[model samples]
Target: MVVRIFGISIVVTVISLVVAYLYGGVEALILCAILGIFEVSLSFDNAVINATVLRRMSEFWQKMFLTIGILIAVFGMRLVFPLAVVWITAGLNPVKALDVALNPPADGGEFFPDGSPSYETALTAAHPQIASFGGMFLMMLFLNFIFSQREITWLSWLERPLGRAGKLDQLAVVVASISLIVAAEFLTDEANRSTVLLAGLLGIVTYIAVDGLGSMFEVDEDDIDEAAASSGGGPSQLAVVTGKAGFFLFLYLEVLDASFSFDGVIGAFAITSDPIIIALGLGFIGAMFVRSITIFLVRKGTLDDYVYLEHGAHWAIGALAVILLVSLKWHVNEIITGLIGVVLIAAAFISSLVRNKRLAPEADAEVEKSTPVS
Candidate 1:
């Protein structure tokens, strides 16, 4: 099972590194390795969150996610995304955009390089809109999770109050709207303010549409009974869905992937502007690990075992959203962004170990009681 899950990622890693070394010698190989490390470190939370969704999907959909979805994640975001940004911002056609991205001009200024704005510059120019969109989309996810009813709480002192406050109608929307407004009003310059606001509103709308539609169309499929039993169910951890409902859920995952990629790709550029190198590192290596990790977690039931892992991942998401919004005005180090998730997740993992230990004796006693005079 482990080999089945991670085989592609391992294959991708070796091939990508070989390609990287060939493309730019040992230096590129080293940089590619570093970027791969960065992406995995920064997006471990992504795996945890993705596992939550993957478990709810059917076997067919899950396979598609790991296969077709991996392709989309690798090439779509890593290759096409930056190219599209450059195409639009640099006034180049698609072909021209690809060409320019592949061959950045040698005119050496900062990002622009004393020449017409390079692909890197165009991408940087588009950051405010990108950040606003991705940040709000992510913020909505975090807010929705944090403000909902859950069986467990990792940080009771904090989550308890937030959950209580969530009782109000549309509180998540209200909070997310206020956050968008705050980012626009204080963070963005007047010239970009309207664009930022529009992007954020679109983010919110996209979330509502995808999530709401998925929920509305979901019906208990034939296999839901098995899913429910396996989950030891109160209403089932897995929602059996097919057709449009399933498609919407799939769409939600992709959009969520895009939101995460906005930063991950940018961080890759910070190391080197070569699109091919970025693809080798961030796409093939890093993204492969992320998806494989999601599969591993689902199969191993790791999230269920480590109860607070989901909570920590969501909190890290919340922090990332804040950082994105803050970065609209000021610089936030990518290392700091990556470390935030790592630290929160680590703390949560340790806390879960402690919690399991505390419950062990009680569980043993209950088992003894149930055993009776056997």
Candidate 2:
């Protein structure tokens, strides 16, 4: 399974190298490899969270994720989305933005000869908007997930209280809104303040809207049973309905992917301002590996085995959200961002190992009791 999964990564690496070599010789190839690794490291938690959702999806939907979803991830989020942002924020047409992105000036200057902002410069200027939106969206996701009712918790001390607070309807929204307003008013620059605030508010609205839609469309077990009875459908047919219930989940996953990609797209500029390299390196290679990891986790039931994995992933997400917000005002090293997630995930994994060890005896005893007395 590992070989099967990483086989594609190998292929992607080779293709990326070949393209990079053709683009600018050894230096470009090396940079592309580094960028791919950077993306993978940064997005490990994304893979884990994706697995949690992917496991709930139907086989058809899972296949869609690998096929159709990858295209969206690679092209839509990596290439078009960034271009759209440059278009909207920099006051350039799509053609102009694409041209500037593809051909950044030699001096890495902010402007072209015609006095228009370069694509890289425009993208840098638009950071506040991207950061605010992605940060708030991710913050709400973490807040809502942590605040929701759950039987198992990795961080019981904090998560339990949050879960209790979640009983107050729309508490996540209230918290997110407050956070956004505070960041915009206090932390943001006076010039970009309105854009930041608006983007943040829009992010919150987006989260609420997407979540509400998911809830509205989600299929209940009772509804499935009732439908089966009415239609004289058997267990297999009921299972099919249950599987198809993942339609909303599929949508949620795609939105989640977009949210995560925001950071990756922005961060890619640190390596090279070239949009094509960013798309190929992070979008194609890194994202493909992430998808493979997600599929691996689902097929192996890794979440069930490592119970705290989801908890750790969410905690990492919360940290990343906070970092994204902070980055609007302060420069944060990508290394710091990556390490915090890696450490938290590692701790949660170690804790899971300990928990399983403690639970093993109890499980064995229960199994023995259930067995026939030979």
Using TM-score as the measure, the top candidate is 2
TM-score for each of the candidates: 0.93, 0.95
Give residue 319's error in model 1 in angstroms: 0.2
Q: How many Å off is the CA of 102 in candidate 1?
A: 1.8
**RMSD value for candidate 1:** 4.1
TM-score of 1: 0.93
**How would you encode candidate 2's per-residue C-alpha lDDT over 189-262 as one tens digit per residue?**
89989999998998888888877766665666688778788778777766655555566677778888888887
Residue clash pairs of candidate 1: 109-113
**Taking the candidates one at a time, how many backbone clashes does each contain?**
1, 0
Tens-place lDDT digits, model 1, residues 233-341: 7453564346556677788899998898889888777899999999889999999999999999999999989999999999999999999999999988899999999
Model 1, global lDDT: 0.89
